[model samples]
Target chain A: MRPALLFPLLGLTVALLFAGSLLTGPAAIGLGDSLAALFRGEGEAVVLVMREIRLPRALLGLMVGAALGASGAAMQGLLRNPLAEPGLIGTSAAAALGAVIALQTGLAAAFPPALPLLALAGAVVSVLAILGLAGPRGGSLTLILAGIAISALAAAFTALVLSLSPNPFAASEIVFWMMGSLADRSMLHVWIALPAMLAGALLLAGTGRGLDALTLGEDAAATLGLPVARLRLAVVLGVAALVGAATAVAGAVGFVGLVVPHLLRRAVGARPARLVPAAALGGAAVVLAADIAVRLIAPDRDLKLGVLTALVGAPFFLHLILKSRGERP
Target chain B: MTLLALDRLSVTRAGRPVLEGATLTIGAGEVVGLIGPNGAGKTTLLRAALGLIPAKGHASLAALPPARRARAAAFLPQQRDIAWPMPVAAVVALGRVAHAGSAGPADRAAVERALAAMGLADLAARPATELSGGEQARVLIARVLAQEAPLILADEPVAGLDPAQQIATMQVFAAHAAAGGAVLASLHDLGLAARHCTRLVMMQAGRIVADGPPAAVLTGAHLARVFGIRAQLSEGPDGPLFQTLGLL
Candidate 1:
């Protein structure tokens, strides 16, 4: 497909999925009624459900999904590896660790913004650590190895925190938070994460040209006048803010970032620059669809969004591995 | 006028010197072949000249601002890595990255011209990674050509090409020089260097052991002393013919 047509198609799909997300739930809210309540604030119960509950859910899904998708694409482009994702750099794991701390200490229940704030802090620390570990001229191998070590450490610490929690209630809360969800979010959640996500998305967007140059390799890109150090900084900070804000709002959602970019890369002609926006749109659509499916598949049970994404994404990941193996000589 | 000048440039890697006090100047309309045995700092010199690595002393091109430096000189590294399977055209278009937001008709024309120059016009839509090694090398060379810089630094740009393709690639560099650009290419093929390069600079043990015209620099004594090889030099119809007799 031509690059011009690809964006609009992805945008329309995301819009349709957004609408689908808003219309789904236990209540029998008709599409027309939901649209009316969403736009015109008609009918008391309809307005309450649409405004206070479903609207926030759909908005979070779009924002968080877009963040993960764009971050994933940027990560892959920077590392020049197709399998790279937001989680690879330890941002998601570190953010999850922060949120787990908030839950275990009962700070999240006491204060609403404390969860995301701490999570963002964790992401910032992880970015700093990775940058410090991988020096200015460190190659991709060094960066990847550093990220793996940081991720493993964060995961271990998070597990330790959960195991040592004072009560089973706190442990369960931490477990549920780690499972990832979009339930009971408010406009406050949207307002808190929106600015960081926007800033991160802007940073990632500016790296398109640099990322394109990087296809030639780092030395060639540097010689092409790309300040490779600055590019790395921007990508790291941008991904940190995005995945941090995302995990803060919706727990530790996985696979959307890793899966969406891989799926849309071919459609974008495998150009890293074009894949950024396409993956963002595709991510939003996938997350919204998954969120909707979660509601319909098991309405009585509180089905987690991360669980469903893993259920779908893990198989796709395996298939990609097998396909790659088959193509190898 | 000198398009590139290196004044006593020196580089040390892992606490060991790789290039020591290497002074050279490449004038416009000259193709200077950097010839040296393995670990003789040919690659290091090109990299340091392009500011890809840290070194002592000064490289004139490295002193310019990054974008201005990029516009002034295009570099092709020793490694030809195409990480993604992007189309040939898209990969070649990456040369215009430094000129971002300024691309217009001229940039498109340059890309088309480069593709044609490297005989890649027919494979413009093919995935770059799917191409053969020689084809991929040509594509990368096309990418450098599209940069349209006044100076070009290429490290082993024609290493994997067939004999015909190798000559054609050298001719492309010669043509670039004839069009008022300066090219400093590191080469291992003594014969190609003797035939195509306007001048030759031979290095040994992190220093330039000889620098002059090919006929003056690639003599039997220098070959035996620097490369530890006995070479027979004779004049062929086209240019100087170099034949390695045996290891000294």
Candidate 2:
């Protein structure tokens, strides 16, 4: 698809899925009632449900999906690897560990913003570590290896936090958190995640030209007058912020980054800079659609968002690996 | 005008000198070919001169700011890398990155001119990754051309090209020089270097052994000592023809 057509189509799809997410809930609220209560605040109970519950969920979906998608595109562009995403590179996992630490240590309970803030801190640390381990001129393989190591270490620490917890209820909540969901979230979560996500988007947005030049590899990009070091720094900080915020608010929503960019790469003609915005919209659509599916699949039981995304994304990941293998000698 | 000036440039890798005390200057309307045996510091010299790597000596281009450096000199690496399947035109348009803003008329014209020069006008809309290896080499060369910098530093620019394309590429570099620019290309093909370049700088083991006009630099002694090759050098109708007969 031409960019002119692709952007609008993706925007429309996101809008429809946003509506679907808002409308599809276990409360049995009608579409008209939901919209009226959401915007006009008409019905008392319905207004509470719409404004307090559904609206924030939908908004978080858009924000988280956009962050993941944009970060994924930026990562792929910087590293010149399609498989490079926040989750695979340990950004999300490190963020999750941060959130876990905040929860278990009662920091989140003491302060409302500590959850996402700590997660952002965690992301920054992990990203810095990845950069250090990967080195300045690290290859794709070195990056991935470093990421795998960081991810394992972070995941182990998170599990250690869970095991060392005295409160079994908090432990159970941590387990549920690990599964990831949008249930019972309020406007507070949205406000908490918003600033970091916006900051990340702003940073990643400036990297398009650099990423485009990087398609010719780092040495050529440097010769083309791009500040390659600055580009890497921005990408690192941006990915950390975005992934940390999203993981803090919505546990670990896996594969939205990987799957969305892969789906939209062709639509955007495989240009990394062009892929960022397109993938952002496409990611929002995919997540909203999946969020709606989770609600529809088990209206009463609360099906986790990660479960749905992984169900769809894991097979897609396999397909990508097989396809790439076929393409190689 | 001197487009590039390097004074006693030196590069060390892992505490060992890879390029040592290489001083050369390239002026406008000059196509200077850098020829040497493998690992003889030709690549290191070009990189050090362009300020792509940290080096010990002064390089005029290296002294400028990155943005100004890009406007002054464009470099083409030995490796041909097109990470995505972007259209050939899009890949070429990336050359205008340093110019800022979207692709304006001037940028578009430069891209079109580069495409036509490299005979890739028809492949403009095609995915660059889908082309044959030689065609991809041409596209990369076109991208370098699209940069429109006054000085071009190309490492093995014609390595993968066919004979005719190689000649055409050398002609393109020559044309760039004729248009008041300069090109310093590292090449292994001594014949092409001898015939097309206005001057040749030959290196042996981290040092320049000779630097002058092609006829003066491509001496039998330089060939034997630097490249370890016994070559026959004769004057063809077009220019000097250098043919390697056996190892020294």
Candidate 3:
């Protein structure tokens, strides 16, 4: 892509983000107050909201979005399938199940932590299971089938928990969370997932060349001296970590991971490596916009994050499916 | 040194036998054409040479076991789909995956040379999946060339190419042999085979019925027997010639 066009377009989206996060809410804190509180030099109620609560939430949204975006791109690339999205593979569903189980068992409360870790572990396990079921030499269909299996298994398990729940709110809350949300998230959630997601993202970044080779097909990739099986392993683990961490904290936020990467393929000149960064920025933008929309549109109802994304994303997803179908095989 | 050697090889897929007790050998710097009737196990043979399919056989490439044959021989399957809009250069680079630990300067040069040889230098930036059938065939061949292995096993390399592309692809295979590399390509074009191949192995059912220079193997009766097409064989200045008369 022309650097001039690409940079500014991406820069502008990121730039607009500052306003979406800051300008919303009844307080209506502007750039000045947000920046001041961001510096930790300001001492006021406005500063407190901007600095402590809102800032972390916004940063966390950025991290979650970036994680989803990068992991999604990597999954599509490694699988060599455009329809490949991290959420579709049941990583998020499995992670959400882990978080629910942790909470229900009270182990997470007793440990005062390990909830995100457990969630991440659950996601990785599901991914591995999918990989195993798909077989080492399996291509797009194999991965897709494996992913559906994981999603079904995880969703079923989560449903089982909800059915067994004594609290009426637990099932609905699980539903809302599975639908995805970023409301009432704390700095603690940020600290839990950010570092690990970031690490996985960087690992994915290093795999751009490998992913490029994968476009030719696995047999071709293997002939290039690349360990095709090993690449599959790395990509699966990366998806689990990033999506698991994000879902564990933010609930199973749908479509951002899927749509962000699809759009970024065009944004970053259609290169897989280029799509990674673009997807990251685009993911952050999409999530933050959805988050703000959720908050502003139904302040009383406190619309779930997942619900907002699905409402906005469902039509777009359908359009994409139709568009892809019309094109060549 | 021998580039590929298969002994007492048998291939079965889904409880059906494709090849049973098939034996073959290709020496370094030789271009061998595998000519077979439909269901004669041409693809199965090529695949077995690369160990892509499980077979009960003793296959060796450069004294290495069958499992590591990819490091010694490059394989190009008959049906190829890139699945993504990949750059041609990236597609070709997949040929070097077996050399992961030590990708030296030679690997890069081979990639460039392969692209240039296949006349894909200009199309390197384009998406591979978008290319036409002939272009994809060339690009895939370039990928195998980049593998830089001594033995090249290609299935139906000219299946979909125009006459010109068929000639050009044959020239590339000829060039590989000239450069002291081994090549084994399954071909239906008997004329091209007679012209370029150092040896020809003709198959009927799942076994080799004839193996020798093109002159001896592609006899008129042999074509009629295997292909169910009557033809006349005559010697030319260049090589053995076949003129198909009609369906048997």
Which candidate should be chosen as best, given lDDT against the real structure?
A: 1
Best by TM-score: 1
- Tens-place lDDT per residue, model 1, A1-329, is 88889899989999999988899998899989988998998999999999999999999999999999999998999999898998888888988988888888888999978898888888888888888998766677888898899999999999999889879999998888898999889998999889889889888988988888899999899988999989987888888889989998998888999999999887888989898888989999989999999999999899999999999999999998898789766
For residues A4-65, could you state the per-residue lDDT of candidate 2 as single tens digits? 99999899999999988899788999989988998898999999999889999999998888
Candidate 2 local lDDT, residue B22: 87
Better of 2 and 3 by TM-score: 2
| Global lDDT scores for all candidate models | 0.90, 0.89, 0.78
- The true-versus-predicted C-alpha distance at residue B38 of model 3, in Å, is 2.5
- Candidate 3 residue runs with Cα over 4 Å from true position: A3-12, A15-26, A44-48, A102-118, A135-140, A202-206, A267-269, A295-301, A321-329, B14-17, B61-72, B93-112, B121-125, B146-148, B246-248
Candidate 3 residue lDDT tens string, A253-310: 8778778888767545456766777788888888888878877898778788778887
Instruction: Tell me the lDDT of model 2 at A253.
Output: 89
Model 1 segments more than 4 A misplaced: A135-138, B100-102
lDDT, residue B82, candidate 2: 98
CA displacement after TM-score superposition, residue A63 of candidate 1 (Å): 0.9
Clashing pairs in 2: none
RMSD of every candidate to native, in Å, equals 1.3, 1.8, 3.7
| Candidate 1 lDDT for residue B59 | 96
